[model samples]
Target: MATVKTVTTADAAAKLDELLWVVLWQPLGLPRDIRHTLSLEGEEFELLAQENGQVVGGLVAVWTGGTEIELRHLAVASHAQGHGIGRSLVTEFYRIAKTKNCERIHTIARNTSGEFFRMLGFQTAPGQAPEHPIFREHGISFELMERFVEQGTPADCSTAARSRGG
Candidate 1:
C-alpha cells in the first residue's frame, strides 16, 4: 500500500532538487533555466507519496491569497505513474484546501496532464486571455484549469427573524 505524507519546506528545500530532476526535469524535458530556478523556499504546501520507504510521487502548490491556490508542480516517478499515486495526492490537496476555506484551486497544465486534471473535475478557465501573467511570460502553451469548491455556510434569515420578533 502507498502512503502519502506532507513534505515540509525544510525537507523539500534539500530533497526537491534531486526529485525534480529525476521525476520532472528529465522526464518532462523542462528547460534547465526553469529547473535551476525552481525553489521550495516559500512554498505553502507540498505532499509526497511513499511506498516501501521510497518516494513515488509529489506535488507543490502555493496559496495565492484570498481563497485561491495554484499548483506549481506535480510529478510521479515514471515507474509509478499509472498506480493512482497522483490521484491520491490531488485528493489530499483538495481536502486540505476545503479545510482552509479555499474557494478555488487552479493549475497550468501541460497537454499531457490536462485530461487527468479534467478527470478530477477541473475545467478550462473560460477566457480568451491568459488568466495568469506567468503563462504569457514563459510562452508556455498550456491550458489554465480551475475548480470551484462548494463550501457549506450557515444560511442567514435575519430579515424574516426580525419581522417575526416584531
Candidate 2:
C-alpha cells in the first residue's frame, strides 16, 4: 500500500512544480508558473502520495471559507496510474478536510477525469456555469463537481472501498 502525507509549499515546491508542469500546465497550454495557483497564504494545503519512498501523486486544496474547500490540482504520475495512488491522495484530502471542519469539497475536474471524480461521490455542482471562460480559452472543458461531508459520515472515497494500510 502507498502512504499519503501532508506537505507545505516550501517543502515540496520543486516536486510539485515539476509534476503540475507536465501533468497540468503543458497539457492545458497554460502558463508554467503554478505557484500563483497553489499558494499557501491561508488555509490551503498539499498532499503527496508515495510508494517505497518515491513520489507518485499529489493534490492541492484551498479552504473557500465557511466549511467549504476547493481542490485545485490533482494528478498522478503517468507511470503510477492504475495503482491506488490517486484514490489514496483524495482519501487523505477528505480526512484532512474533515479535521478542518469542512462540510463540502468541490473541484473543477477535467472532462476526461469527470468519471473518476464521480466514482468518488462527487456530483455536478448546482448552478455551475455551462462554461468556464478561462479554461475554454485554453481548449479545455471542465465540469464543476462537489461532495458533501457530513459529520460522522464515512466518505465514499471510491467505488470499491479498501482499507488504507498503515
Where does the lowest 10-residue lDDT sum fall in candidate 1? 153-162
Question: Evaluated with lDDT, which candidate comes out highest?
Answer: 2
**lDDT by residue for model 2 over 1-166, one digit each (tens)?**
7788887657575686578678777776667775585454457788877778777888989887788999988989888998878888888888788877889999988887887787677779976645756668876687889988766767547632332221
Q: For residue 21, what is the lDDT in candidate 1?
A: 67
Model 1 compared with the native: what TM-score? Answer: 0.74
Give model 2's TM-score versus the native structure. Answer: 0.82
In terms of lDDT, the poorest run of 10 residues in model 2 is: 157-166
Q: Give candidates' CA RMSD values in order.
A: 10.0, 4.3
Q: Backbone clash tally for model 2? A: 0
Query: Residue 103 error for model 1, in Å?
Result: 0.5
Report the error of model 2 at residue 128, Å: 3.2
Best by TM-score: 2
